[model samples]
Target: MVQDTRELNRTAVLTELLRIRPASRKQLAAASGISAATVTRAVEQLIAQDLVVEAAELVSVQRGRRAVLLDVVADRSLVVGVDLGASNTRVMLADMVGSPIERREIATPIEADATALADWLASVIDEIAGERRDRVESVYIGLPGAVGRDGSTISNAPNLPQLEEPGFLDSVRARSGRPVRADNDANLALLGEQHFGAARNAPTAVMVTIGAGLGAGLSIDGRILRGSHGVIGEFGQLPAGPLGTRLELMVTGPGIMRLASEAGVHLDSPADLFTPDASEPVRSLRAHFDQALLIVLTAATVSCEPEVIVLGGGIAKSLARDLARYEAMLEHHLGAAPRLTASELGDFAGATGAVVAALHEVYRGLGVDERAFGDLPVAVPASA
Candidate 1:
C-alpha cells in the first residue's frame, strides 16, 4: 500500500466506509488503500463529527482478536432529488445511504415563467426539508430538456420553453439554500437505472423514453455522456426510415396515435391502439413501431455497443408487457443484444437518480466516483 497523502486520508476512509460499512479500521484501510493508523485517525474524526459511529465489534482475522466496526449514521445527512417534467414534477428526500425518506408529486407550474417555476420548486424543497434543513447535504434536479454544463443553464427545451430562460437554474439554487445541481431528465433516467433500476452495474447503457415527447440518455464507462451540447440523447430526429422520416413521428405516443388516425380510428392512448380486438390497420401499427425501435437499437449497438438498453417513460412502460418480443428483436437484428429491460423505479426513477447523483457529487472528492456507487440498493432503515 502507498502512504496516505497529507490531505486525502480522511476522504478515502470516509468514502470507503460510506460505500460499505460495519467494517473495522483494518478493513477500511485495506479497501481505501490507506494505512491502518491513518484510517484510525480518520475514523476518530468521522465519529467526532457524528457521521460515522462505532456500532459493534466483530471477530478479527487474527486469532482471539476483536475489532470495532464503524458504520455511517443513516440520517446524518439527507439529499434532495427533483424531476421536473412537462406535465408533472417529482421530488424526493433521501438519506446519505440513498434511501428515499419521503416523496411528493404535483403538476408542473406551466403557467408560470421558468424562474417562477424554479421558485415554487425551491419552496417545495424548503417545505419538505423543514426541520432537516441543517442536515440537508445537497439538492440535484433533473429537467425535461438539455441543461448547460454549469448545471443551471437550460439550452433548448420544447416541452417547457420557459425553463430555457436565463436564471431559472440559478433561482432554484439561490432560494433553495443548499448546494444544487441539475441536468436533463433523460440523462437522469439513465443515471437512476444504472444505479437503482434496470441497468444496474452496467458499464455502458442507453435509455430511450416515450411519453409527451421522445428522448434518449446514454452512459459510457459509468458516467453520463451528454455530448458537446448536451443533446446527444435527443432521438426525436433520428432517421427512422430509408428516405427521411423522424423517429418521433413513428414510435412515440403521438406517432402511434397518428397511425391509428390514418387507419380511421381515434386512439385515446397507445393502450387503445394495441388492444387485441383492434382494427387490422391499427394492429399493423406494431410493424411501424418495430421498425423505429430497430433504428434506435441499431444506432445504440453500432455507436458505443452498450452493455444494456433500457426503455422507460410512460409509453415504454406500456410496451414493457411485450418485453421479450423487443429483446428477441434486438438479438435478431444486432447479432448480440445489449440487455433490454423495463425500469424498476417506475415514476420515481428520475428523482431517485437525482439523489444518487447528489450523493456521488458529495463524495466525489472523497474517492467515490459516480461509478463506484454501483449496485448498492437504497433501503429503508430497520427502525423506519
Candidate 2:
C-alpha cells in the first residue's frame, strides 16, 4: 500500500522464499502479495548485491518455457558465533547456512572479567576473518545468564561476576565493534539442535543442558520461546531434589561429588563415579542423578509436552552409559516416556548454537555485520 510497506513486504518475501523454497520472480510475486514488476526489481537488487543468484532454469511441462530458479547465495554472507562460559570461550565462523568454516576454543583464565573476555573473543574472530573480514555479517554470543529485555545481563547470574557492572552490553559492543546478540546458552542450544541436529523436524522440543550448571531451552512450534524477562527455561538452583537440593549444584560434576562425599564416599572425579565395584559413592551419585533427571523431565513435560527431549552439555556425555537409568527414573514420575537422545555437537553445542542464532539474525536483517565495523580500534593487532 505504502512505499515503506512495499519495501518491507519485498524483504519479507525474499526471506520467506529463501527460508521455504528458492523460487523465481513469478513465485515471489505470488507468495509475497507484491506485483511481478516489484518482485523482479527486488530480486535484481538482491542479485546485484550477490545475496541471491539464479540456481537453475526450470521449464513448465505444459509449454516448456524456461524460468530461472532464484536461490540465496549462502556463502556471500557469514557470521561469528561466540560461546562464553565461566571457564572457557569459543568462537566459530560460519556461512549463512550455519555451516562452520573455522572454530577456536580458548580457556578463560580463572578470574577474567567481562571486558577481558570480550577482548579475547573479538581477537579470535579477527584472526579467523584474516583478510576476508569484509564478508562477516554478525557476532552472537551465548552465555549462562538471563538476557534482559533491553539486551543487558540481568543480576541473576552469580557465576559471571563481571556482568554485575552497569552497561555490560554497551561495553562488549564498544570493544568488539560488531553487533552482538546475547542469549541464554540453553536457548541457543535448543536453536542449534533444531537447525542442525537431532530435533531438525521436531515442532516442539526441549534441550536440557547438564553441566557445571543446569539449564533448559524450549522450542514451541519450531520457534524459540524467550519469556517476557528472557528467562524462559533457566532451571538452575531450582528445588530439584527430594530434600530440596538445588538442581544445578546437584546434577553437575561438582554436585555429584558433593552428594557422594556427603554420603561418606570419595569421588575424586566424574570418571570415578563409574567404578566397577559399585561403590556407595557411585551408587549414591547415580541415584541423585536419576532423581534430578526425573524432576527435570517432569517439569519439562508438564510445561511443553515436547515431542523429544535432547540431553546436551558435558554431563550428558559422561552419563551416556546410564541413560537407561535416567529414562527409567523419568518413567517412574511421568507414565509415558518421551524420546531422549544425547547432543551430537558435544562441547561445541553452545558455539554452534551461537552460529545458528547469528545466521538467523543475519537472514532477518536484525544485526550488524562484523566487517561493517567502520573505524573501531583494531582490538587485536592485525599483524599478529
Per-candidate TM vs. native?
A: 0.89, 0.82
Q: Taking the tens digit of each residue's C-alpha lDDT, what string does model 1 give over 55-171?
A: 866656788688878888878878888988788888888888887788888888888987688889899888878799888888988888887766666775777898888888788
Query: Which residue pairs show backbone clashes in model 2?
Result: 137-369
Cα-based RMSD of the predictions, in order? Answer: 3.2, 6.6
lDDT of 1 at 172: 82
Query: Which stretches of model 2 miss by more than 4 angstroms?
Result: 2-9, 20-41, 55-68, 275-277, 366-384
Candidate 2 C-alpha lDDT tens digits along 1-384: 686765665575565455545577778887767888878877786778777788876746346776877877767888888777766777788776555777877876637676775566667777877775788878888877778767775555656767656777677777667788788888887777776677767869999987766788988887778866777777765775667767777777777777777877776776676665676647767766766767777788777889888898777877677667666767777787677888866667778778877766675573222332111111111110
Residues forming the 10-long window of minimal summed lDDT in candidate 2:
375-384
Q: Note the Cα lDDT for every prediction shown.
A: 0.77, 0.71
